[model samples]
Target: MFAMSNPERPVRLGFVGVGSRGTSMLQTALMLEGVEITAISDIVPERVERAQQLVMESGQPKPKGFTGEEDYKKIADLTNVDAVFTATPWSLHTPVMVATMKAGKYGGTEMPACDGYEEAWELVETAEQTGMHCMLLENYAYMRNVMMVLNMVRHGLFGELTHCETGYQHDVRYATIGDQGELLWRAHERYLHHTGNRYPTHAIGPVSQWIDINRGNKFEYLVSMSSRSLGLNHYVAKNYGADHPNAKRQYKAGDVNCTLIQTANGITVTLYYDSLSPRPVDFIYRIQGTKGIYSGTLDKIYLEDTSPVPHQWEDIEKYVEEYDHPLWKKYGDIAVQTGHGGSDYLCMRDFVEAIRHQAAFPIDVYDAATWSIITKLTEESVLNKSKPVDFPDFTRSKWRERKPLPIVNS
Candidate 1:
């Protein structure tokens, strides 16, 4: 358990982008004691003003507000801020975080922190050079179910973890197109024809922790493939008719992206990213070991030679309750009210703790960079005809000897 350096002095945070995700993150932060929103910045004036009102309404002093494209820099550079949390678009994550680190403040950025390998490596170099903390706000890594599995894996209940699978299998066709039926900048991405697992870390984060990836084990190489871009068009045609402008629009993102990864310790992981598909939200996480297997979707568990009914699956709820991640056991209720099925609050809590302690956070710069680089690696593999792309060693060589921080106190 980590404690704030000066427990009496409240942690000051400067937030940029008070839109959908940012608003939720800000609200969660507001709920925690001894935290203050000192400044809020966003490109939209209304969002900035709304965040200012939220902070004032929460009994905190009115936070300074700024609106414009580059105003986040002002917030990041504020001397009073202990940390900077940016929930902006994907392309801006790296730049904003890099700026925060250079300014000597902790930076917590939204997921897929970087779009490609080079930018992720840049973050590594910057964090090391500045000796600043930059964490990936990977909410999935903090989910109660995922953390429970992590605890189970650490206790050796699953035996030696051999291979695992995880993915972001959600239907976001509505978010992509929006209600107006116009392709926003976010959706325009789907209209392009590039291949690879564009988003890999959401699924990889919790699994990496379960298997101690980036610590003793490191991802080696990845082979990726993507189905043609047809899901979005199919959905548009089905609902909006073939004459709908979007139905005729060219989509570049594949219908589905499946990737295979092999770690240095001979562990295999399968990942998926399928946002355009018309399907219910799915987790598709499977933890496989020599002795047992667990499924996130089915909430089912099967162990070799150790079940009341041979070859029959049993409910995993008992295991989850017994081995729930200690972090969640302590704060699951608070997290649940915040968002993302209780993970968002935990993720924010860790980020704030890391900032206050100025110590190695649960997800350090190395984890952020390593997990983020998978996005670019997958793109390369897809463009190269599903050829294997070797993953980068962001740590130089520290991974083999690095030990993971205790995620759950046994």
Candidate 2:
């Protein structure tokens, strides 16, 4: 662990892939105390320069910049950098993380962290061999309602959790196609050729924490199916001429993909990916247990013992207020100014604090692999008549002995 012996020392950071999302996270990092942006890299030299300007505007020295396709390796090797964070394209996430860990620096990446089973296994094996941490900066896990739910779960308010239903249900058709009706990277990488839960980490990350996945329990297997692909074809044909090549292109990704997972402890989870359809953004975070249930879609709860009336849903605001996570309670006001309803700030804070103190990350590589591998697993299952796919035990049976995540009050 490369901890600063003095906690007051800044956690120097190098950032890779400084596009829109990366730049936003850079701005968020600048809000943190005792953090130094030491270096920046992006395929676009303009983005590298822009990120450097942001760092300089923050009153820090202008960070060194790199723009080569493989420049992240250079950032990983810098002696001044204590950690490296990458918000690169989906295919680049695992490579950047692997490079950083091999260079003996903590690594953080946005979203699924890795897409394929090979990449997932490589991530787990690399972290174990190097004794370095690679965290999936899954911001959803820190959202206000989800964190409160995690707190309630830990406190036994949701007694003996038996089931959960969560999904990433957002329309991103505009993002997939350019104004000129050209295919974007997401269209090629996620929708054009693959089908299944392409983006499951956002939904599964929070659910995993609540169910103690990779801690006291682990995902055993899952079966998945997907609806026919139609949203993108309709979107393209409507916006552009019906004869446009994009409108006629065959997309493999189904508009709605569903996967049902069973945990070693017998908890069941229904996960969904519905980005192609026109819809409001709803994570559909529903958790049920022996005593009560909470519905994130409705933002309501039904508790058998605690409710004043039985069998009726009540507003969850009071329960959230009563069981707010400590991290949220302490940082709510400041975090609200950042992205994703303050989850960005809180999640980044945890990453920084863990690095500063040389503490184990709340969401470590094992959890990252377990949650991220769902993409590939779901794809395999969907293509094979929804056959059951066993989860790779990234923990190697250690989950039976690992303790549940404690409420991180400090």
Candidate with the greatest lDDT versus the true structure: 2
Q: Model 2: per-residue lDDT, tens digit, 91-146?
A: 99999999999998999999789988899999999999999999999999999999
Q: Which prediction has the highest TM-score against the true structure? A: 2
The candidate 1 region of ten consecutive residues with least summed lDDT is 1-10
TM-score of every candidate:
0.95, 0.98
TM-score result, candidate 2: 0.98
Model 2 spans with C-alpha error above 4 angstroms: 1-5
**What stretches of model 1 exceed 4 Å from their correct place?**
1-7, 190-193, 239-241
Location of the lowest summed lDDT over 10 successive residues in candidate 2 = 1-10
lDDT of 2: 0.92
